[model samples]
Target: MYPFLRMVKELIKFRNAPAMRVGDIHISEHRCWPWDIDLWAELNNGRTLTLYDLGRIPLAQRAGLVSVMRKNGWGMTMAGVSVRYRRRIRTFEKIEMHSRAVCWDDKFLYLEQSMWKKNGECANHALYRSAITDASGIVAPERVLSAMGHSAQSPEPADWIKRWIEADAARPWPPMQDKR
Candidate 1:
């Protein structure tokens, strides 16, 4: 089951947080519970993605993207993501998470998130490409930002992000059909 209750708690907790502009970081902390563990007694890999929502959703609300989406009848969805997990997160251990929108292009918005242990080790990091959608199709990110009151052009993407975008472009769509 999804952690719907935990997500609601986070929403309520940040209901009045100071509004953040594009690119500002939103920080929060969370603990791993027994249900979050895998056979190795560590936080499950898939759960890490779900836990990220606890931060990402609040980040969106704080940045007013949620409001913009609601007002315009837009929906947001992840188009792609890359995550690196270097350290193990054990059950009952607390981690600090940092999340922020990095930049965007006409087609997609980018965001980054990370989790850190108390001793200052970065346990994991993820880069996400997302899109705003309506009934017709994907809505341009620039249009979404305009609706959110941010008119500035996107900051230059980092070299790694640029490389990733390039690399991903070479991957075939509707992948792996030949094997069947």
Candidate 2:
């Protein structure tokens, strides 16, 4: 189930927070609740993705993207992602999540996010490719940026993210047509 209540809490909690500059990092803290645990007694892999939303949406808000999207009838959606889970997060454990936009191209925005344990260990990290969309289909990142009152020019992407994009582009789309 989506954590709607948590999202509302985040929104209200940060309502008066200062807005962040474009490409700046947004940080937030969260706990691994009992309901967030897997049978292995650690944070569930799927739930981790959902929890990332707790940070990403606020990041968007701080960037003023959410307001622009609302005014323009645009929506944001994840087009692809790569995640690494390097450490375990036990129930009741607290973590600090950091999120930022790494770069953007004509088509999509690339974001990097991570979670760190209070003890200073990195628990997980992820790279995401997201698109802004309208009724017509995917809206160009340039257009989205312009609507948000920013210049259309994006920073150069890092080599690793460039490689990941190239790799993803080479993958076959609409995969797995054959019976298992």
* lDDT digits (tens) for residues 1-180 of candidate 2: 899999999888877889987789999999999999999889999999999999999999989999999999999999999999999999999999999998998789999999999989999999999999999999988888888888847888889999999999999997869687
In order, candidate lDDTs are: 0.95, 0.93
lDDT of 1 at 75: 94
| Highest-lDDT candidate | 1
Sum up the clashes in candidate 2.
Answer: 0
Per-candidate RMSD vs. true structure?
0.8, 1.0
Model 1 score (lDDT): 0.95
lDDT of 1 by residue, 33-104 (tens): 999999999999999999999999999999999999999999999999999999999999999999999989
